[model samples]
Target: MSVTNQTTVTEFILLGFPGPSSLKLTLFVTFLAVYLLSFMGNTLIMFLILMDSTLQTPMYIFLGNLSFLEIWYTTATVPKLLATCLLETVTIPVSGCIAQYYFFFSLGATECILLAVMAYDRHVAVNRPLHYSVLMSIEICLRFSAGSWTGGFIAPLLPTILISHLNFCGPQKIDHFFCDSDPIFKLSCSDTFLAEALGYTCSSVVILTSFLVTMSSYGKIVVTIIKLSSREARKKTFSTCASHLTVVTIYYGTIIFAYVRPPAKYNFTIGKVISVFYCVVTPLVNPLIYTLRNKDVMKAFQKFLAQKRFLLTRNMHKF
Candidate 1:
């Protein structure tokens, strides 16, 4: 069908998870709670990282950025998802859909780069402990962080632009809850070869390269740990990398499975499940993973609470 002949689609209907009407309330409550938890948890992580001078390190700095990213990530999709649960049909204007698409992919790509950078940070800290500070200096950390953000913003530009220009005619229904590339691309009336090519190319370069870098970094860290003589020393050394490793596994595992594939091969059922994990569940779990596994974060949070209590008591006495 020619672009000119097809009817222009001004808005899209998102066919979110379909279930019995009875389950609507349960679904809405579940997603709403997840969104709030993700928001508060990530906010707390960022706040603690900023206020606590004790956490002023390269690792914590990257974590603060990740926390900030997770907050926006959930915001990009969950609200609309909640709406779909409550409403019969969830409609989104074309411009709004495009905007959501851009921010979601950009943030996701930024996280990929950040995770790789974090892995490299761990690599340096563990393998070259004596020179870690000198190697991963403040200047270096800022440059890498800035580069990740910049790369993320730029990486999706070509693909998103290509996708935006494509014609979306009738039957403007997106299978997924969000305005992801695959679903949007599937709806286009024009030839989507270029968009798909660009998307797949970008996904491969960003995801595969980042995954390899992370794996390589961890491999080196493992090698370095084995060389240590003391059992306690080795255990302690591995502990530092544990939280990051866990997060990396969860993030990359779901994303790679979801995006790194041909559109024709995409199973809607599996894609929806994987999308929920990466989009909803992962963000909520991130703060828990970091806080519970990390003593420093827990201590900092406790101290913050104690200080607030003390201030409240002191102010009450004055009143």
Candidate 2:
């Protein structure tokens, strides 16, 4: 194979949501709201899981980490997107693009494995309640969380490194809101086939493998739910799993659509629409779906509020 030794590309211009200049402010405000809510909501959940002694179980521990990941994950892309929409120029240096994709992929990859581990936690809890603590012990939880973070960053790193070495001759524009791999790859003047192929292989490792594990865990869980003798018990179990299943399915479906599928001549309009779901909507809903509906978390939140009120009243009396 022949190689081109040429000047390396230094920067890229992002072609954010395609629309009239008139609409930029509108889009900015809307997505800004999303980004803020996603960050604050996830942050609040993380705090609750940490401060509330009632949430020391294996499940809440994982959920807390997931909330933290969601906050960082959305932060990876949303701030840049907001800036691009409102700033004078949407240019990002080559290094910046790499950094963005790195964190984005890291947090994304972490979430994939994290979700699977959470599913496994649910399975152990529901199907083997007596042994739940034994199976998902503190040590085991730490390992699983560490593995997920490790797994998330391992595969995607090399290809982006490969991309970093490539030359970009002309057309320094990235036709997406952020430095998505596909959009950035298009900016490269060099042949990107090998880079894309490597990326696809890496994606399979992080995405397909983790997805299969999660699905298998859930399958056994469903069977156990059916075998449950009491209808009330079955209802409670299904209720616990349903929200998780919804978020997982939506997150995976969008990922498969955006990344697992081959790169195409994307209609930026449609791409931006789908991007909203994964980047914005999922992050916004993650903490809510996982913890907001949870009775234990709600009870803990109420208790915290009561204590805060009591403290305020006592301080006022002393003053």
> Of the candidates shown, which would achieve the greatest TM-score relative to the real structure?
1
Query: How high is the CA lDDT of each candidate model?
Result: 0.91, 0.84
Q: Alpha carbon lDDT of residue 273, candidate 2?
A: 78
Clashes of 1: 0
RMSD of each candidate?
1.1, 2.0
Instruction: List model 2 lDDT by residue over 29-81, tens digit each.
Output: 99999888888888888888899887887788888889989988988888878
Provide the lowest-lDDT 10-residue window in model 1: 261-270
Residue lDDT tens for model 1, 233-308: 9999999998899989999999999888876888876788799998999898889899998999999999999999
- Model 1 stretches astray by more than 4 angstroms: none
Q: After superposition, how far is residue 262 of candidate 1 from its true place, in Å?
A: 1.8
Could you tell me the lDDT of residue 291 within candidate 1?
92
Candidate 1 residue pairs in backbone clash? none
